[model samples]
Target: MDYKCTLDNADSFLNQLKLHRDRKEKVAVLSDLGGWERAEGMIREIVHKAGADYLVLDNGSALDIAKIVAVNGVFKTDCSC
Candidate 1:
């Protein structure tokens, strides 16, 4: 189901600075994934650029930083990777 994420109802608050998560070792790229398979492409880009591991979970899922990673990579991650 399509979801509308706003500041009030966000899984994790994206600070006014738009700091959704710690940009130091993790990066959350909020975007549209036509499908989980399709979204992996974006995940890889994030991983490559951020030089950090990633996770992809349902946007509506809880804010469990421990469970975020790419969803489409061959790494067999739950997100998309």
Candidate 2:
């Protein structure tokens, strides 16, 4: 699903994460190591609070990221497209 980052979509994103958790599915937050640097701590807290995993793509490629997503179930991030 295409998720646009905006205040309106924040709640929806959190809800989606919660839903994934409720289903016993693995939910994660995938980001570049410095993608959300300023808010890294807060982001991790929020994701973990919602029972999701937080991952940083330090030097990983797109394929690596895809592999993680494929194995992890679902991910919610600030990425917009």
Candidate 3:
């Protein structure tokens, strides 16, 4: 899904991605990472540590969409998405 998120806050954005993943929805974050390189790294790290799946895209990259597959024992699903 095309999700719009800002780099002003890393924690909040990561939480949103987790919420989507909990619902078995693959996330493709859309943003301009040209100058927000620091935020980009933080967000990637956060998603990686969560053991969730995600794809970060700027604008020109070719899209490779995939369904969010369920992991055996990832984060518990308590999100109200």
Candidate 4:
């Protein structure tokens, strides 16, 4: 199943990955770390999907993600191909 993953907020990107994993979906995120917030259970689902090893590239922070959304705004989902 191919699904379009779009984040509506910077910090929520990882959360999105977690959301995806809650349904047992594998994903990879490549983006910034500064935007990552330390919220509880923020990465619980992600950690569970670690078998697939969904990564958040900070380019090194160990705490990062591919955020289509960066704070004051976000990206729209378009799955037309």
Candidate 5:
């Protein structure tokens, strides 16, 4: 299942991660913000800790991100607005 979450709502995102932990689902974090390297890195660490295979698309366009996610068959988790 695809999860739409914001970095501001970290609890909800963690909950979602927990729910999928057993399934060993792949997680993809997409962000268009150019100045949030620290925030992005934090989320990446969280995803790593969750033991989920992840892909990060930093400062990418919608179409490019979509294509990559589709090809990867990963669960898209938006962590940025």
Candidate 6:
């Protein structure tokens, strides 16, 4: 289902999503809050640059920040010479 989230609650919502017990319970971001518009835009741009198919958070199953790190190549594997 979809949920309306604000900056105050965004972290909580994503954290709950990560901690969700039911695998079938689908939670998606319903709408972007005015207070978080700029942050959302930045996130959307980053997701877009990461080759996301769409800008909506609902397009994905989770909204955790870890997803961003994965997309932004922060977890790259390196080989030592």
lDDT of 1 by residue, 1-81 (tens): 943323322232223212322332233333334432222111111121243333333343222222322211112122322
Which lDDT tens digits does candidate 5 get at residues 53-79? 333323321222212221222233443
- Misplaced by over 4 Å in model 2 are 1-12, 36-81
TM-score, candidate number 4? 0.30
lDDT (CA) per prediction = 0.27, 0.33, 0.31, 0.37, 0.32, 0.28
Model 1 / residue 16 / CA error / Å: 8.1
Q: Each candidate's TM vs. the true structure? A: 0.18, 0.29, 0.29, 0.30, 0.28, 0.24
The better-scoring model by lDDT among 2 and 4 is 4
RMSD of each: 13.2, 10.7, 13.1, 11.1, 11.2, 14.7
Clashes of each: 14, 0, 0, 0, 0, 0
Model 2 Cα shift for residue 75 (angstroms):
8.0
lDDT of 3 at 54: 44
Residue 28 of model 3, lDDT score = 39
Runs in model 3 lying further than 4 Å from the true structure: 1-11, 35-81
lDDT value, candidate 4, whole model: 0.37
Candidate 6 per-residue lDDT, tens place, 1-81, comes to: 933223332222333333332343333333233221211212221122353323333333323242321121112122111
User: Backbone clash tally for model 6?
Assistant: 0
lDDT of 2 by residue, 13-50 (tens): 44443455456544344433534211111111223323
Give the per-residue Cα lDDT of candidate 5 at 34: 49
lDDT of 5 at 60: 28
**Any idea what lDDT model 5 has?**
0.32
Candidate 3, residue 81: the lDDT equals: 19
What range of 10 consecutive residues in model 6 has the weakest lDDT sum? 72-81
Candidate 1: where is the Cα deviation over 4 Å? Answer: 1-17, 20-23, 28-31, 37-81
Which candidate should be chosen as best, given lDDT against the real structure? 4
